[model samples]
Target chain A: MKEFNLIQRYFTPASLAPDTLLGVGDDAAIIQPPAHQHLAVCVDTLVAGVHFPKDTHPRDIGHKALAVNLSDLAAMAATPRWATLALTLPEHDDTWLTAFADGFHTLAREHGVDLIGGDTTRGPLTITVQVMGHVPPDQALRRDGARPGDHILVTSTLGDAALALAQWDHPNPAPTLRARLTRPTPRIAAGHILRGRAHAGIDISDGLVQDLGHVLKASGMGATLQAGALPLSEAFRHAMGDGTNWQYPLAGGDDYELLFTLGEADVEPIREQLAGQGCPATVIGRIEAEPGLRVLGPDGAPLTLEQGGYSHFGN
Target chain B: MKEFNLIQRYFTPASLAPDTLLGVGDDAAIIQPPAHQHLAVCVDTLVAGVHFPKDTHPRDIGHKALAVNLSDLAAMAATPRWATLALTLPEHDDTWLTAFADGFHTLAREHGVDLIGGDTTRGPLTITVQVMGHVPPDQALRRDGARPGDHILVTSTLGDAALALAQWDHPNPAPTLRARLTRPTPRIAAGHILRGRAHAGIDISDGLVQDLGHVLKASGMGATLQAGALPLSEAFRHAMGDGTNWQYPLAGGDDYELLFTLGEADVEPIREQLAGQGCPATVIGRIEAEPGLRVLGPDGAPLTLEQGGYSHFGN
Candidate 1:
């Protein structure tokens, strides 16, 4: 398809607000936030062979790139409003572009975010998405606000993505396990719920232990995760026997769930509200005065893992 | 240099502003914009084989990737404040990473932009940068504001980068020509000068004519270009005989210069101010009440040539 044709067919959806002075057809997009809202911006990139397996579906690739960035907005306790996509492709295959846009637009619209601006270039199969969300300046949650007495909570089960990845290399894994790796849902609503209440927050891209380590480092505090309180999906348990699954839960990447800290007094009400919305909430840890992350195993001693979570360069 | 070590050494420069609440080392950077200013954001990616040659210098790749995005910010007349880099490499090579960061940091620091947050992944070599700048809500330039009879102006000489690129496959034409392709000077100062004066603008990434095509299409107007007025760098002229250089001037990509439109009344004063600042400004076209771009060759007939721009899917 031609460039303008590709834009009209896959972009320029009504989900975008008219407040956007300029969107996809220019050098860059122009947007103005509502009077009381501050813009929360972040970018993430996914390469063909690096972020996902080479054989992964194009639709999933599109979903995950935007999903990972939405996860960033979630960590900030912001409401995602708009996004710009920078896509570098080997060639313009109409079918691939369509499926990719389908995946991206469906999720963007569902989250009430619009595709505002982007650039398409001829290059390798790489997708970079910059997401912008709106938050009242005072209510935007960040990783620097955790206090020693705060309660650390995580949304939904962990390790399913990592476990699913392990089974991904297998020729045939169960359908459920495959979908977990292919299309993990980002907890958007849970983030909105925690916006005003969370003291600090972050999305788990590089496993719970490593990602939480970032929050601890930023907040200048420590954390102790309760091993028994960790939530695991059935798919996670099936891939790694009960005990082994804990390692993946703590170190496996690509969960896209929010790990946030809230004031101890606010947990009960927040948890009830989240439960009302049919989202999972678990108090897995607590913030501490010190500055290192530790995990207490089921036996109540520090759990030692062979390696830390996935690093870009690999541990 | 390992990923973390490289980040700490090269990427973690002190922020220029006190309001920079967060700089690198976190999942995302945080900053409080001045109360009166709005944020302008843009992202651009350069792949090794597609955007540049496979064996292109890492330093040049780093410079161009950031320069291109900065050019976008410049088009919007935004003062760049922060950037996030996402690099995907095939392996963990110390030399390459060090040089890449060195090139990136040098330009970033010069522009007062800090590397706030980023992700490093293992894959084919690709660099994606998302840059954010500050623009007063009422002062940001856009591509849709050009009115009929506006004078279209461009900064510096055009077609040098394209000529330099053409020389790439052959022999190095000259040091001046080579530098044009290898090191692009984003029109930051010129953009700042034209901020409130220009009615609309866009950086010329896809050749002067094609990019201006975007401005015209968006403004719902037409343009008439003076072929003789196309600015030619000394190196471009040396490479192209005066008559033939028109092709390069009109169609070469990678120039990263600002092509903007100003009201007829503001032209003389803006030009005088820019001249005082030691920047060259050229008025080569005029926005018309009609609705298509027309180029008048030396003979004053409509000029039509093959499309001279790059598109993601267009060959």
Candidate 2:
């Protein structure tokens, strides 16, 4: 199939939002921005082998590609409106395209995002998704608002993705663990609830310690994360017997959970709000007046990790 | 260097536009869209070897990546605003990054575009740029407005870039020709002038014939072009004595010029306005009531080209 036909057949779905003025076949998609709102924009790229295993499902690749970008918008407490994809594939595969589009459109419909525009080219497999959304200017969550004595919280359990990756090549890998790595849930509802409640926010893609480090650095504050307080899923705890695999949650990457800071007085209320929405929030750390990160072990002593987090290039 | 540090050092230039509330460092950039305007968004991807030769300069790659996306925005008659880049590189090279950033930022500054936010990852060389701009809702140019009697116009020359590619492997290619292929100028100014006057518009990145075919298909009109009226640059004419190579202009891709349609009455005024801005336009054809494209040779008879245009997959 030709480039235009492929895009039309696979990516162009009926518009879900009314704000898209000119979608898909145009040189550019014209979108009507809602009045009195700030537009949140983010782009993320996923390479075939670098970001996921070569044997990964095409549907999963498509899902993860959009999921990661939406996670960024979720970090900013933005409601997704539109997304443009730039997909480079080795060649046109009908089955692959169908499955990929199914996965992408499924999540996009759930979030009410329109696939407005995209480009398809011939090359090694690579997917770049740019998601645009809107958030109230006054209520947009940022990473520079953390204050001393604020409680740092996260949505859902962490490190399940990393643990899944570790067992990806195993003969009998758990399907639930694999699902966590391949299809991450963007915490859009959690982000919406934390908009006015959370002082600072970031999505934990590069593990808790490193992602939290970004929040601390941006806010110019320190943080103390309780090792025992880091929520682990039953799957993770059962797989990691003896319950001492702190590195996965601390320094492992690819967790699409939201990490935010709430004022001490607002923590319980925000947590209850998130729980009511089916996504529970856990207070794993607290912001401090100092300017460095420290993790308290189960016994309440300082703990150091062998490695920080996943960086594209080694530091 | 780590991914974050590389982005900070190279891609994170000081913000130029005041509308950017948050840029570069955040999970997502926050921008305040101007009221009473429709946002135009588009994305384009460039892969090494597929889009450009492997030996192409890093600076050229960077310039072309942004230029192509800007051309799409230009086609929509949108004033350029913010852009997000998703760059996947094979490895870190300091010199390449410096030159690439210089080329990218230079063009971005010229167009008053801010590098709002992006993601950097390690993989085969690929660059995906998503650009967002704005235009008055009523004045936004589209590909579906051409009338039966409208005149088809194109900005600047068409085949220079294609001719440059033809001579790319020569011992000493012309610098001007090489520049045309490497850094074709985007017709943002022409697009601005065509906003309220043009019937339909598109960028000639996939050759004039193919790109104009899109306009015809969308507008539900046919077109007849005078092959002799196709504008050729002086260098192009000088290089080909007794020129009969119509394929270069008709079927060659990578010409980042605007191909638009204007009513008979608006033609001269729009041409003068564009020429006043230092970009000249040519009347190549006229829209017809028929439903197919026809090219008349200098002898006034119909001409048939060997190929239609470049497609990602062979037709």
Candidate 3:
């Protein structure tokens, strides 16, 4: 098939959102940003074998590519509006393209984010997603907003992706854990709720400790995370046996959940509200004036970690 | 070195444009788009060996990655503003990073597009650039706007890049021709000038024949081309041996010049004005109500070519 023919066959059927004035066929997509709102833009790249295992399904790759970008928007309290995908494939495989498009179309429909314009090239498998979103003036959640004494919280359960990763070699693994690893949800709605309410935010694509460190560093503050309070899922606990596997929740990455902060006076109400919206937010730490991440054990002592996060370059 | 540290050391030095509310390091970059202007977004990916030669310089790779995206914006008559780069490298090489960033920074500075947010990863070389620009309502140039009897025009010269490609294996080559091949200038000024004047527009990434096909398909029109009227550079003629190498201008790709259509009345004056702006427009064809491209040879007879243009998956 021709390049245009391939794109039209696989990527054209997905419905476009109203904000996209002109879609894929145009040189550039024209997007109507809402009045008085700023456009929040971010790009994320996932390389096969490096970012995901080579055996990973094409549909999961498609879902994760856009999800990671949506996670970025959620971290900024921006409502995803449109996306452009630069997809580099090994070759034109009809079966893979169909499954990939299906995965992409499903999540995009749920978020109402249109795939506007992008390019497809022949190469080793790599997917890059550039997501655009809108945030009302002064309502965006920023990393620098976290102040000393602010309470840090995370949405949903932690370490499920890592738990699934640890069980990758197992012939039969828990389906819940595998789903978390392959198709983690981006908490865009929670991000919308936290706007003007959450002091700082970041998505936990990296480890909770590492990502929170980003929030701390950007805010000129530090964080003291409570190990006992980490919302590690029951599936993760059962999968890892009775032994404490704090490392999974603390240092393992790939959980696309939201890690944010709220002030003392604002924490409870917003937490309840987000919980009502199906995202259970658990307060796990407090921001401090000095810089550094201090993860406390259940007995309130500083815990030692063999790894901080999944560093792309470092072992 | 850590991935974050590498990014900070190399990719973070460039000064941001004032419109960038948040530049790299944040979860997402927040840009304050100009009021009443719609965001024009486009993404382009350059994979090593596919988009450019595997032996191509890292600097050229960097330049072309972003240049292609800028070309898309130029086709839309949008003012280039901000860009996010998703860079996937096989490994962290400091020398290559410095050269790549230098090339990227130079073009980005020239275009006044700030590097806002993106991710770097470990993988095969692939540079995906997503560019966002601003276009005033109803003023954005579109491919679907061509009308019957509209005069088709192209900016600058064509076939130089293709000629250069043909001579890639020559022992010695012209420096200027090589630059044309490796670094085609995006015709942003031409797009800007053509706004409200040109009826339809497209960038010559996929050659005159194929890209014009896009315009005709979108506009529900056809085109009749004058093969001899094609603005093939004199340098191209001198470089080629005596042969009917008209396919260089007719079917070769990656020229990065603007191909557009304007009403017969609106053509001349705008052509003169664009010439003053350093982009000389040449009318090579005319839009017809019928569908399909017909190229007339210098002998005033219809010309037939085996290939229309470069298709990644086709001959």
Candidate 4:
């Protein structure tokens, strides 16, 4: 297969946005950004064996590659408008390329994101996606805006993806847990709802404690997380019946849920708004003037954690 | 080294663009696109052993990674602005990373481009760069804009990089030819000069014939090239004394020169304009109403090319 033929066959999906002046088959994609909006740009790379199991499905790889980048836009309260993919593969497999394109385009169409441009090369399996979106300049959620006494909230649940990884060698892993690992949802609509409301925001891709610590450090504040208030999915709870695997939620990575901060008065309203969208928002911590992260157990005593988070280089 | 520490220490160069509202350390980098301009977005991936030799210098790899994407922008006649990188490496080597960053930042600083956001992962070495620039919506040089009888032109010379690659294992490759291979300049200034003047444009990354074929196909036209008119650098001419290696310029890849078409009347003015900027432009072909590309030898006889261009998957 020629590089041009491969791209035209698998990657050049029709544009969905009117602002895309030119899409694929050009030197670069030309886009007209809507006036009064700031462009939010992000890039993420997922390497085989490091980010996913080597045997992971090509469809899942495609889905997760875009999902993680969209999660970043969600944290910024940006509406994803376009994405460019740089895909590296060891060999040309027709079935794999078809499935990968299907997975990528399925999510892209769902989010109204145009597959504007991309580069496909031959190498070890590595997928890099750069997503571009827009948000009102003043309303863009940032990590440096958290204030003292603000409430730290999270969308949906965590630990399912981590649990899926831990049980990968099991005879039968739960489909719900495995799905969380392969197809984590980006809280884009929830991000839009949080715009102009949340003081600070970040996507929990690197565990709750580690990602929240970033917010605290960036905003020059501290946080007290209530371990009892941490949200867990039904499947997660059932899988870990004794609740001994708290580290999966607290320190394990790859959740893709939004962790955000807001004032106490707006919590109920924001929660209700998110509930209307079929997503639940839970208050698990509060920002403090002191400058360190603390986790409180159900008995109201500080609990120390053994691990910080998943670091790419730490291992 | 932790991922965050690695990013902070090596990749987080301070912003040089005021419009970069929020840079690295955020969920996404935020930038205000100047009003009345369309954004040009492009991405390119370079794999070790595929795009460059396994032993290529880290600095040249970094420079070329960004340069190739900038060449895409140049072909679109866009002014470079911001870039996001997604790098995959097998491990952390401080010396390699520092040299790579120096190379990337050197070109970036020279072009007034800001490093806005990026991701670093552990894998076989691969670099993907996404560059965003601004071009007026009406003035972008696109491939589909050529007309019959438009004179085809190219900036600087070609075949030097191809020659250098052929002599890579030699004990002493010509320094000029090696630099052309390792540090091919993007015709950004020449692109600016071609905007609103050139009817169709493309960057010659995948050989002159293949890339020019793109322009012809997009414009629904053809071209006739004169073999004697193809520009050759002093290094290239001296290296190939008898000029038997015509395939090096016609079918060899990695030249990064701008290939464009303009009216015959505007040819001299455009060539003079480019020459004033220290880049020479040569008229090598003319667009034709007929629908196939043809190359003429020195005796006015047609010449056949043995190869098309570089293809990632063809091998």
- In terms of docking quality, how is candidate 3 classified? medium
List per-candidate RMSD values in Å.
3.4, 1.6, 2.0, 1.8
State the lDDT of candidate 3 residue by residue for A1-315, as single tens digits. Answer: 114556666777456667778887788889888988888888888888877888888899889988988988988889998888888887888899999988887888889888877678888888888888999988888888898899999999998988888888789989999999999899999999998888888898889888888888888898899999999887888887878789989988999899988889998899899989999999898999988888899999999999889887773
**Count of clashes, each model:** 0, 0, 0, 0
- Lowest summed lDDT window (length 10), candidate 4 chain B: B1-10
State how far residue B21 of model 3 sits from its true place (Å): 0.6
By TM-score, is 1 or 4 better? 4
TM-score of 2: 0.98
lDDT of 4 by residue, B96-166 (tens): 99999988998988888898888888888899999999998788989999999999999999898998999
- The lDDT ranking, best first, is 4, 2, 3, 1
* Predicted complex 1: CAPRI docking category: acceptable
Write down the lDDT of every candidate, Cα atoms only: 0.78, 0.89, 0.85, 0.89
Q: Rank the candidates by TM-score, best first.
A: 2, 4, 3, 1
Residue range with the least summed lDDT across 10 consecutive positions in model 1 chain A: A1-10
Complex DockQ per candidate: 0.38, 0.66, 0.63, 0.66
Highest-scoring model, lDDT: 4
**Fraction of the reference Cα-Cα interface contacts (below 8 Å) that each candidate reproduces:** 0.35, 0.82, 0.81, 0.84
**Runs off by more than 4 Å, candidate 1:** A1-9, A144-151, A169-172, A219-223, A238-244, A262-264, A286-293, A300-302, B1-9, B36-38, B137-139, B145-148, B169-172, B241-243, B299-304
TM-score of each: 0.89, 0.98, 0.97, 0.98
lDDT per residue for candidate 1 within B89-183, as digits (tens), equals: 78877787777777787899889887777766677777778887778776777888889989999888888877877778775467787787778
* Runs off by more than 4 Å, candidate 2: A1-3, B1-3
Give the interface RMSD values of the models in order.
Answer: 4.3, 2.9, 3.4, 3.1
The CAPRI quality class of candidate 4 comes to medium
